[model samples]
Target: MLSLNSSAMYTGASALSALAAALLGTGTFWPIGLLYEAANVLVAIIAAAAIRERGAAGH
Candidate 1:
């Protein structure tokens, strides 16, 4: 749940950063956008691990 929440937040942030970059025509937002994307990937990995653990425990 926490992972999912974080993923959602990071995804939102990334989208906003992209929009800002597009509007401002600056490369500055690119790095922030990349960072957010990386965070989202990490959160997704954590969520997958948690789900796998839960499934294993259930069986």
Candidate 2:
């Protein structure tokens, strides 16, 4: 059975990243990071709005 531990997750991520880098090349990865950051910001904004609404509702 596979454990959902930190080391397992780290190794999995490392492997995926190496695969992506090998397939996509280094220069392409840098520009793609902007899209990743944009996605992160969008999720954070939505989560913050949801939390604020929940707090306003006294939950």
Candidate 3:
């Protein structure tokens, strides 16, 4: 369940970032793009940690 939840969260964040980047265009307004990218990375890290904890608990 945790795995599925994390995957969904990661996927949603990625899709949102991509959509924002496409709509905003990544030129002079690169800070917003960078912010989205950073958010994606943060989400990935959090999901990974959750998955890892879930795995460890089964052992």
Lowest summed-lDDT stretch of 10 residues in model 3? 22-31
TM-score of 3: 0.53
lDDT tens digits, residue span 1-59, model 1 = 99998998899878977766675676465666676688789889999999999999999
- Over 1-59, each residue of candidate 2 has an lDDT whose tens digit, in order, gives 35667777789668756766664766467655765576579879989999999999995
TM-score of each model, paired residue for residue: 0.55, 0.51, 0.53
Give the winner by lDDT.
3
Spell out the clash pairs found in candidate 1. Answer: none
Model 1: lDDT of residue 54: 100
Please give me the total number of clashing residue pairs in predicted model 2. 0
RMSD, model 1, all Cα superposed?
5.8
Steric collisions counted per model: 0, 0, 0
Task: Highest TM-score: give the candidate number.
Answer: 1
List the global CA lDDT of all models: 0.81, 0.73, 0.82
Compute the lDDT of residue 19 as modeled in candidate 3. 71
Write the number of the candidate with greater lDDT, choosing between 1 and 3. 3
Scanning candidate 2 in windows of ten residues, the lowest lDDT window is 27-36
